[model samples]
Target: MQETPFCLTFGHILPYSMSDSNTTDFTNPSTFILLGIPGLEKAHVWISIPFCAMYAIAVLGNFTILFIVMIEKSLHGPMYYFLCMLAVTDLVLSTSILPKMLSIFWFNSREINFSACLTQMYFIHCFSGMESGIFLAMALDRYVAICDPLRHSTILTNSVVCKIGLAVVLRGSILVLPFPFLVRRWPYCRTNIIPHSFCEHMAVVKLACSDIRVSSYYSLSVAFCLISLDVFFITVSYIQILRAIFSLRRRDARLKTFGTCGSHLCVILAFYIPILFSFLTHRFGQNVALHFHVLMANAYLLVPPMINPIIYGVRTKQIRDKLLRLFTDKGT
Candidate 1:
């Protein structure tokens, strides 16, 4: 007696036996096929061009930020230390998806081992959460500097910064640690083809043969709880920062104070806006195109990493001066 094959459709698996040799039995498939943006498969080659460019820029830009902060002794403050953490997080986040994504586009390597897929899923979410925590840390640094300038040094000391970094890592890790384990418990006795580029949490969960409400609820809860709290704290910090800026009588002083936060604000918007859009669209926007959601998801991870260093270099006077001096000395 031939075993029945399973087909996954619309987030449910239906068992159906087919005599056709082409219909592969994906029940407990060892490797999953990642269809890189299902509807726009033909355009994957064209899409790879920009994705590749963004990835290159992100790697170079982040490495540049890390190098500058490391070499410039004056930049060894709590703020720059936080910036370094952000840069590292951005690098890990983007790298988690792009290399395999590019391979899927350029080389037609769509199959990813199940274990590898799970690992990818873990790293992407872990680093994403860490990135948000880093943003919150950066916001706190700005708030302290602007609102309590005299005590900023004493408050955000080197030891305190180290502790904050550790906390951010542990928080992100502990929150996202359950993802892979939860996913591993399910039996993926359905079609092992994921429609997006990478192994996203919900995407992989939808392939499971069992009830996915646990995975869905946990993911939603984690996302909402972590992001909401981070955003709330960041908002309060900035509000206090704004109050401090407004309290200064001199217009120039106000401008200077607010200008210091400009880059952090831009980077925060770049990070959060696309992520929120993608998350909401994925969950609620059923009418929206699948390709659009995939593109936005990829964009959120790639864009911030690519442009963060640019925003900082352009908006922060110290970084700009240092970058210019480095280039000038090289040219000479």
Candidate 2:
């Protein structure tokens, strides 16, 4: 959305207007402006280059993972099943924001319809929550495999993995479905200039003329309840996995066990560190530059999708070998 100097609010007189309450009729605007990046207006042209590159890599990388896992019979298991789900979620999350963001940078098309914005907001949050859930599932997969190797196959069968994937999607969608409706019901009297790249929940909620305590609290509650819970379980799983590794009598076996977790640990850090930073910076970093906060917010969205495949490709021998063989076969 394009930024404007002024916006009209209901039941309030326009400054320097001669008309009184009897003469004024308030009309709610049909569209909102997404201010792409605060204070980086001049660099938008340069910014789009790297943004486009990252988007391209994220799509290609994630798609490769999905393709390999789907066709390679060797990789058909609970772990790879969850990885495939992660690739899908990353694709959705990246696609949800990057194209519109690019439009703003390239064509200066910043106007998004109110309904469209809410839809975008819903998908962004839902996909993110789903990714978090998928991470938790991966953690559980690793926990069962390492901590209880004998029962791993029995515990997480193909049917069970499918059920877990379906449950993750449904849980995320159900929890995030209310966010758009909550924002849509509010009367937006302030400037609809969202000071970030996308229709992030809090940024959009802050524009409401009415008290936003309910929406704010609800959003915070969901973040903590869902994201935090996912992180907690993942941490617990890793801890148990570590304990299991240490209990191994053979050094080679211990290293191999830790090696199995290496890729996941890289991915877990890549996904969560930026998220935690963005969450804290958005809430408590008033003294920090708004543009920096906005940049970090964009980073949180963009970085994980871009890096996940790289981490997997490098650290995951099956994926790495498949990628090499695929390319080599193509070359020959």
Winning candidate number (lDDT): 1
Question: Per-residue alpha-carbon lDDT of model 2 for 1-332, expressed as tens digits?
Answer: 32222223111322222224312332354776776876677798899999899989999999999999988999999999899899988989989999999998898888788889999999989998999999899999999999898999999999999999999999899999999988888776536666677888888877666777788788998998789999999999999999999999999999999999998888889888888998998787756776787788788788889999989889999999988999999999
Backbone-clash count (model 2)? 3
Q: Show the colliding residue pairs in model 1.
A: none
The RMSD of every model to the true structure, in order and in angstroms, is 4.1, 5.1
* Clashing pairs counted in every model: 0, 3
Score residue 310 of candidate 1 by CA lDDT. 87
Q: Show where candidate 2 strays beyond 4 Å.
A: 1-28
For each candidate, what is the lDDT?
0.85, 0.83
Superposed on all Cα atoms, model 2 deviates from the true structure by an RMSD in Å of 5.1
lDDT of 1 by residue, 1-332 (tens): 22222124332321122233314444456777787876777898999999889989989888988999989998989989999999999899889999899898889898899899999999999999999999999999999998888999999999999999999999999999999999888876536777789999988888776777888889988998678899999999999999999999999999988999999999999999999999999888977877787899899989999999889988888788899999999999
Off by over 4 Å in 1: 1-27
